[model samples]
Target: MARNAEALDLVELLPRYGLENYKPNIEINLFGRLYSAPIAIAPMGMPGMVWPGGEEIFAKASHKARIPFTLSTAAGATIERITELAPDTTWFQLYRMPHNNLEMNFDLVKRAKSTGVHVLILTLDVPARTKRPRELRNQLTIPYKPGLHTLIDVLPHPGWMLALARHGHNSFANYKKYTNKKLSGYELAKFARQRSGGTFSWKEVSQFRDAWPGPLVVKGILHPNDAEKAVSVGVDGVVVSNHGGRQLEGAPATVDVLPAVVNAIGKEATILFDSGIRSGLDVVRVMALGAKAALSGRPFMYGLGALGVQGADHVVNYYTEEISAAMRQIGVHNIQECNNIVIRHENALKF
Candidate 1:
């Protein structure tokens, strides 16, 4: 599914380099809060596994960039800790719990608000706990046990061990109190399987919207009908995504369905895009198609994995520069005008 999204392309036009007496404005007005850029760091679980202090690095860089850094309930740093690190620049991604644990989930939302999270992203995908063969094979579980396979895998990487020593365990700090003790890979997996609020109907989604009075965003949407439904229920935004192709392998590419979703919802709600954004041009493409902003998880993750904390800074600035350059070349002054330069290529071919 990730490959499918990557396979899609946006048509480019001849450079109109001389037409710019203006600067590119990439500012985003997310829920009345102004941000310097329209791109954000997508929440990835165990970002630190890619590099030590992964969440911290992202937090600092995001703060510097004046963009929201989404903290995953399953990854990055805890809400409380991230607030201390970056204050109001963080957004929380919520994975709804079952009705049996409704109060606790509500409390979790309150806790996030208490920590100064103004934006709440409710992900409505992953209907069931599907098997991920790669993770299973590698035994990448909660509290990451040093099984034979993993032990052997990390044996040669003295740097990872050193970083781990400095940063300590990478368990879900927010969920630590809920569980009795540190859970092993299998134990944690079992718990998640049992507790995962895999899929949600309209009623559940509406309930969440009513509860979260702040900027409420529903991520992981593909269908135009779903986008319309989100707006009808007073959602602040809809993120066109397929959980980065992790939820369903055969699902349509997010970019392919973006136009329909935008047409359905119109400007009724902010439309964000993700799932297979690899370059600054991709950001331009999504915006041209009709997205308020675009996020790339793996590209940023890869940056962190390749260059420690510095890689994160590079990712932000690199993307920013790329967007500005593309805007100039395509003769668009700002993100709002990017769509004007897009040549309709329904049968678009990738370069």
Candidate 2:
């Protein structure tokens, strides 16, 4: 029953708790993927539109921060390009395609491995496409449809338009060879919707588990039963997410579900969390609740889109500093110490 307003309330409380006096380290491990900090950049699509060379900039920033960066299947750059740019820091996230294209998608996964991607995350919750009104009003579709409205919207932002002209329109570059046609905006969205696996099921999850050789993580999980089922199917980890509250509006905040999901999986599986995590204190709160690590999607994108590479780096550094400060205030030194902290319920109604 977590509301969007509550998420915003927590976001507003972040800056008050600073990291100046805290001497802390925030390293974490996920299926042998060592991170300097438990913070990771969530996979986001169309980064280039937000900032010129968005994926490359973010990847470099992540490398500098010593954290893992995941590349989206629908990102502007190919997985190979992103892996090449970030090397040891890149992971790949898949938006599952229809059953007929499973082999092609598996080939894409193998290609990703060739580029040294160590982890494969399967995003399973986006069965239906969301209609973002702003995007529609701007006529900003996936492979971008350039209508009078779209051109007018672009005319005002000379910087963005200039970048687009220099780099060409932002499209899913990786899928070009497979699709053999150019798409943008609404066409791209329609194409993806036509090709995406709307009927993706648990059986396919099991199939992916057996087929992929690397550590497999199931993202977009919000239910404890789903977490248990993922463990039963041999998933290496489960990311407790509601797709950043973009998919389902009424879904519980990922923080509220972290404890139950961790408890359900026990010590056999890793429990990661995302959604509504805007600052260091929020990261500590989820860690205290039992998350092995935490990630942020829109925050880093905001930094990148608004300030480019430096902005991306600043966001990562800011969170790392924030988490360290929060830990020291609570008398903890490392992520494991977070477990000793407790949540104080506003009212106690149960035994």
Candidate 3:
């Protein structure tokens, strides 16, 4: 019965099954670099808090899966450390700093390039650190204050506590050498606000394009006109995102806006989509609309929080298998074939 149920679910979810049959290939080329799959891991900040050495684990999984893994600016591990773990698979995502620290941020990009990162993803959405009420409730702020509440919370989770102990003081290790400010929970928030881009504009993006030699991808674009502007400013790609809806409450799903963004950019710029992508069918749906690739943030983080590195591996494999099955059922051989597939929505009034 379970097998029957699973089969029915697949058939119902994927109706692009019969018009024409072809295999789906997920390979993608970005600025002369080839990737084995059109899927890339979106940058998740402070993965270490969720799992012991989470960044390295994800990097290894990406290398094994032959997909790109982006390291967040606020990642627990330094850029150099992540690159060392997955030399060929690393991409760097930068959160542009304040104007006063702009040169320092640019220097950081050069440093990332020096460490062998090929792709530089510039995150332009964070005007200020949006309140994450959950973090506040859990007392999971930066520079982790080991308060009685936090200690009590972790007491039941001995394994995670032990791993945290072994990992040792895990504050953004990358920035410690530069600033003497030790970032604790609220302090981390304050520090981020201090350094983050509040006035970042397209002019800054153009400057970054001229400064950085590698492929530049601007993330956090949700509008078609913004995508067009990005291309005009000489960006190589635009990641269609609403910052996983963490930044705003009522932003449209990345899937819904993907087609317009792709059309606006035309074929000259690469269009990647993210936000609320929970399954393989979601990936297929967005790609069909016009995304060159699809990336997810929270799903992988859930896997990491649940099973550490092994959890990360399981999540990637789950997506790969799901995508493969979707291709076979849809009768598409590769990504290109899948791109030509379409879906029709029928009215629900039935006798």
Candidate 4:
């Protein structure tokens, strides 16, 4: 995750001369619908940990901003709750379970549809859960069994503890349909490793296509060839991501691979970028390369943590403000113009 942050600093934006007269229109189109900006809140699990009502806060903000709000299946908020928060502009990120839980997976998909979510973002990167001893050592994994050490660690931050309590204690609400009992701490972590089961499959594309009636986006793609494969499988979009560098230790930075995937897939699929985006400038940087849109996660979490429900809307507005400022500096109007901007700085020069 630190590397993901470091990679963004290396990407310097080159300013274009003399096009500053025309106001940069930040509007964007995704899967035939128009949005106010080229930014969308990326799907993230357990956001409530960062803020009391993180999921619904983001949903409301995204809805007000007229941008897409993606809900992770593992997000503590259920599909029903997320849609209720942002019925019209909701998207869902799905994690397909292994062979035994295939039916359960479809049932979850059904639940997502019931919420009127239009886009199904199938995350292909989480092949399996990687072992992160830090989370286990702190007892911060699912079910979040707070030991004496955890109590000691969290006692200083009463706000976080209270928010965690109010948000219902890290239970995976979407997964509740499968089993009433909640899995937490080590047991939850163990289940993650066991549930990952296998990698992406071409055969599964047909299954998803047959089941979903909306635009299907395959996320977590880093390689050009995989981008080609995703388009060949008939996905409407491909998100260039590396799971925020949380899953793979030595994977390529998303910024490094965005161009390759976009170049390879071309119009076959809409190329979206994720994993390292931190601001409106970062969003502009990726768009100037080739991505049609950028999805961000951490920045909004930062907002939620700082200002509660209002912070969510504040962040969206803040990103929009930043995007407009960045575009004015770069001299572009609208998202399409950013699609093929010239890279003025070869090695991310400091401006």
Q: Name the top TM-score candidate.
A: 1
List the pairs of residues colliding in candidate 1.
none
For all candidates in order, the CA lDDT equals: 0.78, 0.76, 0.75, 0.79
In candidate 3, position 228 carries an lDDT of 86
Best-to-worst order by TM-score is 1, 4, 2, 3
Runs in model 4 deviating more than 4 A are 20-22, 99-101, 161-167, 181-197, 344-351
Residues 1-351 of candidate 2 have per-residue lDDT tens digits of 245326423421212234356577688877796788888899888788787788888889877877988888888788878887789889888887785658767777888878889788999788887766766766666556567876776688887767766776555766765764755445666665566656347888888887788888989987888888888888999888888888776676666566677778958888888887888888887787788888788899889767765878899989988988778877776888787675652321121
Instruction: Give the per-residue lDDT of model 3 (tens digit) for 96-116.
Output: 777555876787788888999
On lDDT, the leading prediction is 4
RMSD of 2: 3.8
- The TM-scores of all predictions, comma-separated, are 0.91, 0.88, 0.87, 0.90
Off by over 4 Å in 1: 10-17, 181-193, 347-351
Q: Rank the candidates by lDDT, best first.
A: 4, 1, 2, 3
True-structure lDDT of candidate 4: 0.79
Which regions in candidate 2 have their CA more than 4 angstroms from the true location?
1-22, 99-101, 181-190, 197-199, 345-351
Q: Candidate 3: which stretches are off by over 4 Å?
A: 1-23, 99-101, 181-193, 197-199, 344-351
TM accuracy, model 2: 0.88
